[model samples]
Target: MSGTELMEKPAAPAKLGRAIPPAFQGKQFPLLAVIVFLALFPPLIQSDAYDLGLLNNVLIYSLLTLGFYWCFALAGQFTFAVFGMYAVGAYVSVWAARHLGGFWSGLVAAVVVTAAIGALTKLAFARCSEIYFAIATMALGSLIVILFREWTSFTGGYEGVSDIAVPSIFGYQLISGQSKYYLGLGILAVLLLLTVLFFRSPVARDLAFARDKGPVAAVTGLKPVRLQLMGFAVGSGIQGAAGSLYAHGSGFFSVEAFNIDLSLLVLLMLLLGGMVSMYGAIIGAVILVYLPEFLRDASKYAEVIYALAILVIIVAFPRGIAGLRHTLGRLVRRA
Candidate 1:
C-alpha cells in the first residue's frame, strides 16, 4: 500500500470512532451475565471460607445499595436514616421471631416497624435540605446504635444476638452459602424488577422531579406528595426486609452491623454507582464488599482506597460504571 494512503486510512478510523448506545438502549443481557457470574463465583472458590463470606457481604451490601438508590436516586431523597431503619429490622426480627412463633411473622413485624420509623423520619425531616437532613439523620443513627448497645435486654448489648435461624422455604432448611446466595439473589431480583416497573410508572417520575417546588408543582401532573411517601415507605421496607434476611443469613446482630460506618458506605455506594440504574447499585455493592478481599490483609487501608476510587469515578467518569458504558456507546455513535 502507498505510505500516504495507509497513514490517512489509519487516522480516518480513529477520527470516525466507534458507535454508541442510544438514549434508551436496554442493558438486560450484560447485567444478567454479571448477576450470574457473581452467583457462581462463591462455589468456584469452594475451599476458601473467606471468599464465600466476602461474596455474602457483597450481596448484603447490594441490598443496602438498592435501598439507598430507592431513596436517593429514584425519589431524590437525601435522608440519612437508612441504617437506623435497618437496625430496627434486625432487632425487631430477632424479637419477633423469638416471641411471635414463625419466620413469616418476624419478617412482617420488622417491615411494619421499620416502615413506621422511616415514615416518621420523612415527616420530620422531609422539609430539610441536604446538609441539615444528613446531619440530623447522622445524629439519629448514632443514637440508635448507642441505644442498641446500652439496652442489654432488648439488643443483647455489644456482644449482639447470635445463632439466629436461617430462613426456610416450604419447610425446607437453607443453611449453606449456596442456599443463602440464591435466597439473597431472589430478593434482589424481585426488588430490582419492581424498581424498574416503578421507574416506568408516573409515581416514580414524580418523586425524582427537580427540587424547585414551583417548577415541580407546575409541570408534573403526578401527585408528588403521595409518590414521595410511597417511595420512602417501599424503599424503607426493602431495607427492613434486607436486614431481616441478613440477620438470619449471618446468624447475628450487633451495634457494628448498623453503625455510622455502614451508613456512610451505603451513601458512597449510591453515589459511586450510577444512581439511576438499579444494576449499578448491585455493582457498587459488589466492588466495595470484595475490594477488601482482593487486597488481602492490606485491606486495612480500604477506606483510603475506596475514597480514591470514588473520587476518580466521579471526576473522571461522571456517569459511573453502569452509565459509562452507555455514555461511551453514545459518544461513539455521535462521533
Candidate 2:
C-alpha cells in the first residue's frame, strides 16, 4: 500500500480489559466502610464510660490537629494560635449559652467570633513573613489566654467556668459519654468530608499557587492575602467548634487547659501523623493520646520517650505515618 494510504488506514482495535466494578472504582466505598465502622465501633468494643470518654478525647484532639493541618500544611500559614482559638471558642460558647440563647447559639457564636478573629489576625499581619506571622499569632494566643484569666466576668477568671450546660438538641441532652462520642464523631465526619471537598476545589488550587508562588500568583491577579485569610478563618472556626464541643462535653474548663503545652501537643500530633495527610491527624492523635496512658507507670520517662519518638519519626519517616503508609503501598504494588 502507498505510504499515504497506509497512514490513513485505521489502527487495530485496542485490547479491551475487564471493566472494573463501580463500587471499587473510587474512594466512595472505602469512605462509607470507614464511616460505618466508626459508627459501630463503640458498640463492637462494648466500651465503658471511661473508654468512651477516651475515644471522645481522641476525636477532640483529631479535630484540633485537623485545624492545624488546614492552616499549616494546606494553606502554608504557620501559626501557633490554635489553642487560643480553642480557648476563645470554649469561653464564647459557654458565655453565649448562659446569656444569649442556649448551647446551639453559643456554638454558632464561637465559630463566628473565632473566624472573625482569625481573619483579622491574618489581615493585620498581611505583610509579615511566615516566621513573624507565627510569632505574632503565638503572642496573640498568649494574650487571649491572659484575657480569659483576668476577664473573670467573661471567662469566669482564674477560677474557670464550671457551670457549662449539657449540650442538647430538641430537648435531648447529650449527657452520656456514648451520646457525646456520637456527636463528636458526627462533627468530625462532616468536617473530614468538607476537608476532602476543599482539597478538590478551585480554592485549594488557588491557595496552593499563592502559597508556593506568591509573587507569581499576585502577578496573575490572585489575591494571596485573601486566600490565606479565608484559610485561617476556616481553620480557626473548626478549632472553635472543637473547643465548644469540649467545654460542653467536659462541663468545666480552666485557662490551664488552653496553655502552650496543649498547642505544642496539637503540633506534635500533626507532625507525627504526617503533616500533609488528613488521615495522619487522626492517627497521630490516637497514638499520642493512648501512648501516654501506657506510659503513665513510668511517668518520669514519658517526656524523654516522646522526644525520642519525635526525633526518630522526623529522621526516619519525615512524612509521618501517612507517608509510611504511602511508601508501603508503593512497595506492595511493585512486589
Candidate 3:
C-alpha cells in the first residue's frame, strides 16, 4: 500500500471484547466488589460497635492514604505534607463549625484552605525535585505540626481540641457508631470513586506521562508543573476532607494526630500496598489499621511484630500486595 493509504487506513481493530479500555482494565471489578461489601457492611455489623468504629477509622485514613498516592505516587511529587494538610483541615473544620454555626461551612473552608495551601506549597518548591522536594515538604509538614502545637488560641495547643462538633445534617445528628460508619464509608466511597475517575481522565494521563516521561511530555506540549500542582492541590484537598471527617467522627484531635509519625505510617501504607495502583492504598490502610488491633494483646511485641511484617512485605512483595495477583498469574502461566 502507498504510504498515504497505509496512514489513512483505520488501525486494525483490537481483538473483539479483549481490548479492555484503560479506564476499566483491572480496576473496576475489585473496587466494585469492595464498594458493595462496604455498602452492606454497616447493617450486618450494627451490634458490633467496636468493629464499626475500626472500620470507620479505616475509611477515614484510607482517604488520606489515597490522597498521598495521588500526589506522590501518581503525580511523581515527592511530598509528605499531607499530614499537615490533614491537621489544617481538622482544625479549620472544628473552628468553623463552632464559630460559623454549621458543618457545611467548615467543610468548604477546610477543602478550600487546604487546597490553596497545597498549591502554594507546590509553587514554593517548584524548583526542587526528587529528594530535595521530599525534604522540603517534610520540613513544611513538621513546621505545620509545630504551628498547631504552638497556636494554642486556635488549635487548643497541647491539650488539643476536644468536644469538636459531630456531623449533623438538617438538624439530624449522627451519634451512633453505625451512623458514623456509614458516613465515613460513604465519603470514602465517593473519594475513592473520584480518585479512580481522575486516574482514568485526561489530566491523570498527562500527569502520569509527565511523571514517567518528563521530557516526552514536555515535547508533546504538556505542562508538567501545572499538572503536578493540580495533583498536589487536589490530593491535599482530599486529605483535608478526610481530616475533617475524622475530627467530626472522633469529636477531638490534637497536633499529635497529625505528626510526622502519622505521615510516615501513611507513607508506609502506600508503599506496602503498591504505589502504582490506587487499590494498594486501601489494602495497605486496612492491613496496617487492623494489624495493630490484632496484635494488641502481644503488648511489647506488637510493635516488633508490626515492624517485622512490614519488612517481610517490603522484601517479598516489592511492588506491594496489589501486584501479587499479577505475579501469581505470571508464575502460573510460566508453569
TM-scores, in order shown?
0.81, 0.87, 0.88
Candidate 3 local lDDT, 237-316, one digit each (tens): 88888888888888777777787777888899888987757777778988998999899999889989999999999988
Q: How close is candidate 1 to the true structure, as a TM-score?
A: 0.81
- In the range 1-335, model 2's lDDT, one tens digit per residue, is 11011122334434485544221223633663575476657634856877887888999999888888778876789899998999999999998998887898888998899989989998998889999999999999999999889898777776789988888878999888888888888888888877766654457667877877889999999998888789888888889998999999998788888988888989889888887567778889988988878788889999898778778887777778767855666778999
Weakest 10 consecutive residues of candidate 1 by summed lDDT: 1-10
Off by over 4 Å in 1: 1-47, 210-215, 218-222, 297-307, 329-335
Q: What is the lDDT of residue 31 in candidate 3?
A: 56
RMSD of 1: 9.0
Candidate 2 residues lying further than 4 Å off, grouped into runs, are 1-29, 32-36, 43-46, 297-301, 328-335
Query: 1-335 in candidate 1: lDDT tens per residue?
Result: 11011111222222247533121134544555566666665656664666667667777788877877766665556667788878888888888888886566777888888777766776788678768977887787678778888999898888889857657889988888777777777777777666655544444334555332525664656555556666677778878887887888888768777877777888777666666467777768877776666666766786787668779887766656667765687789999
| Leading candidate by lDDT | 2
TM-score quality measure for candidate 2: 0.87
lDDT of 3: 0.78
Clashes of each: 5, 1, 0
In model 1, pairs of residues that clash are: 20-329, 20-330, 20-333, 21-329, 21-330
Residue-level error in angstroms, candidate 1, position 70 = 0.7
Using TM-score as the measure, which candidate wins?
A: 3
